[model samples]
Target: MNILRSPPVPFTDQASVSERRSNLLDASTISPAGFAWLMLGISVSMMLCGSVTFFIGFMLMPWVIGLLMVFYVAGIVSAISLLGRSIICNALAPPSPRKHIPDNCFFCSSLGFDN
Candidate 1:
């Protein structure tokens, strides 16, 4: 016996109108909390490393301690800047606009239009 296979349907045909629209809108949205957390974790790690280096430098040579201090200060500055930028971006992102279209629009009934 021979088996027959059908061609795959395109994406537009696989989902309802509402679902497709919702997916498009969701794709454009960014997770602000996730960004903030990632920056915070990286900054903390940098500070921890700087502290360890400073201790090691103090044990080896007093002059090396100054270099480590600079490293520590730079790390702190970077952390503060990243955190401030993340907060500002989260605050400034505008709310998602509503999708509107007349029933008579050419692509209103189908997901064939590209914005």
Candidate 2:
């Protein structure tokens, strides 16, 4: 009996489980009016954070633009390098297998092939 093969132990017994459920049933949940006020508070806090972020970005607009431009150029360079590597790999790869053309095919006959 290794620990990995050991059976799981119950966290709580039946009596304690029933007591906890009874306590939860006795507790009062938030009312609709309280929920509405909670939502209003959350919205106000989010708006305040958003306004602060917007002003900070606006104040550092030039630095932000420069950073964005640098990243855009790096992305373009990476894409071009990836395209070149793929093209080189394709060129170096073996030619594809020859297509099977049936002797009775009309398209092959029109192309002037005996096969």
Top candidate (TM-score): 2
- Give the winner by lDDT: 2
- Candidate 2: tens digits of C-alpha lDDT, residues 1-115: 1212333344656657666665554443556786688789889999999999999989999998999999999999999999999999999999999997678898878888865
Query: Model 1 scores what on Cα lDDT?
Result: 0.73
- Candidate 1 ranges beyond 4 A from true positions: 1-60, 97-115
Worst 10 residues of 1 by lDDT: 1-10
All models: lDDT? 0.73, 0.77
Clash count, candidate 2: 0
Pull out the clashing pairs in model 2. Answer: none
| Model 1: colliding residue pairs | none
TM-score of each: 0.31, 0.37
What's the residue-level lDDT of 1 in candidate 2?
17
Clashes of each: 0, 0
